[model samples]
Target: MTIPDRPLEIIWDITYACPLRCVHCYSESGRRPSRQLRRDDLLRMADAIVAMRPYGISIAGGEPLLVKELFEVTERMTAAGIQVALFTGGWTLRPEMVGDLARAFFRVSVSLDGATAEVHDRVRGRRGSFDRALRALDMLAGAGPVFGIDCVVVRSNFGQIEQVCTELVPRFPGLGFVSFGAVVPEGLASRTGFAEHELLTEEQMAAMGAPAFRERLRALVPPGVHVTATDNLALQMHPDRIREGQFFPALQIEPDGAVRAMPAYEGTVGNLLTDSPAELWRRSVERWHDPFVVATLTPVRTVREWAEATRRIDYHFASAADRERIDRRPAFAQL
Candidate 1:
């Protein structure tokens, strides 16, 4: 069946509370500042999302499972015919939660940065996190969810991509996709001292771009398993066809209900709690012509350059020194 035309997609960060502290976290999410919208407010935002009729909604978080009434929000979106995708750390995902998630979400993408427990535990900054995540994956597999693994390619785990695709993917029968991307040095990553060493080097990034490496990656995955690379800045350079009811294809809804264009958080179009979805959608479309927005949509040589240019265009997002730091980093530093 063909899908109906709708707005691009929405990445809704339900909360910033997370159990594990990964080095590459873009939002720098943690357990502190346990601030999130009330249940009623979330339902209201869900209603707005339904009204907007986005093609897909990615329910993300510091850890989305930490949010109260998460399944209620998921059910609401699903009931309205919105395709919901859950992006989670899987640290807090328990067996009991698997049934609900399997029924509600169209897909679940869990983070798995390394092949071995030692590598993963160190990357996640928590002991036994790898075991817990593996258990959660087992539960999800048993519960019959269309789940996948998201590996953040970094200096420590870059060599294990083949193992992840060959060994890990086959272990989980429910696994349908494996996504890989280099770490982006933004948010908490920028502040963390270890981010410098964790980021993929210029030589590494160039090697990843080489045709031979790409072919090898494709050859590593088994049949029936899909592999995806998360770096798609070039795809976002062109503005959506406004006349065809397509605006910015994706948006980021913060835990506070503020709606902003994805990958760029300097400007807020509107609040999901206070404004109607139509109004917010209109604002996003209008802002597509804003100088900063236009500049951001323009393509650059590398992802780090794109991010630095994006920050420079928005004075309110970061300071001159921060932009300089970001610019000085290697191209794929903020992948």
Candidate 2:
């Protein structure tokens, strides 16, 4: 299919402040400052997205439940006839909020990286997060809309993908899809200290995305439910589009309002705070032909390579200067 004028889906990371510190966190969320746009600024961003009018928009963050205006923004988008969804770590997701959340969101995903608390807590660097996630899911299970879990396939949890699907599928009647994200080497997973023990080999990642393996896992769940294994590197290749010279990468709106082509890389297209989303959406159509993008993606084959490839690209501020310093200082080090 050809690239649409509006992105099929948009992922907006509203804040970097999180409660848990996962080893494979793409944003190093809790470790970084929560560069939240003020309440009015956030509503303005929502207005901008409404104007862009994408098919769907996912509201994500360190923990979206932490943002007091989470539902307000979601309600605005929903009122504008846009499909709004939220992906949360479930740290502060309350039972009271689940009813309204189920009503407003197109899909509600709570992360459960592992089936058991022991494995999950270890990977997430928090003692009681597993239970909290489960409790949140329980509240949301039959509340309304499409409810599901997001499990990142990692070194320690590689074997548990099927187990998570089978166990979770029958448990939550409202559950729709289980996404097995092959952890890309970016953010915290790219940190020098984390690169060695935490990352899974390329072979292991491929095994899950393989068609036969995914089909087998899908059989373990009900027929209506879907299971998918996605490695972001494969997405960078834009496998389904069949186009040449240009690709429509996953559009991500960072907490500071920058619109990044792919969340795994720092290269940005524009910032909503500085430019209209409509204007930035127009620019995104031609971003694939840039010499830097072409050269960077030409040799990328694996998730780890994706991390190495982006280091050489010169990230820019098409709308405004960068908002934060990526530091190696002791105080600013990875958590």
Task: Give the candidate number with the greatest lDDT.
Answer: 2
How would you encode candidate 1's per-residue C-alpha lDDT over 25-75 as one tens digit per residue? 666577345458888988988888788778899998789999879999999
TM-score of 2: 0.87
Q: Please give the RMSD to the true structure for each candidate, in Å.
A: 5.4, 3.4
Model 1 RMSD to the real structure? 5.4
State TM-scores per candidate.
Answer: 0.81, 0.87
Best by TM-score: 2
| TM-score of model 1 vs. true structure | 0.81
> Per-residue error at 216 for model 1, in Å?
3.4
Model 2 RMSD vs true structure = 3.4
Tens-digit lDDT track of model 2 for 37-68: 88999999888888777888999878888889
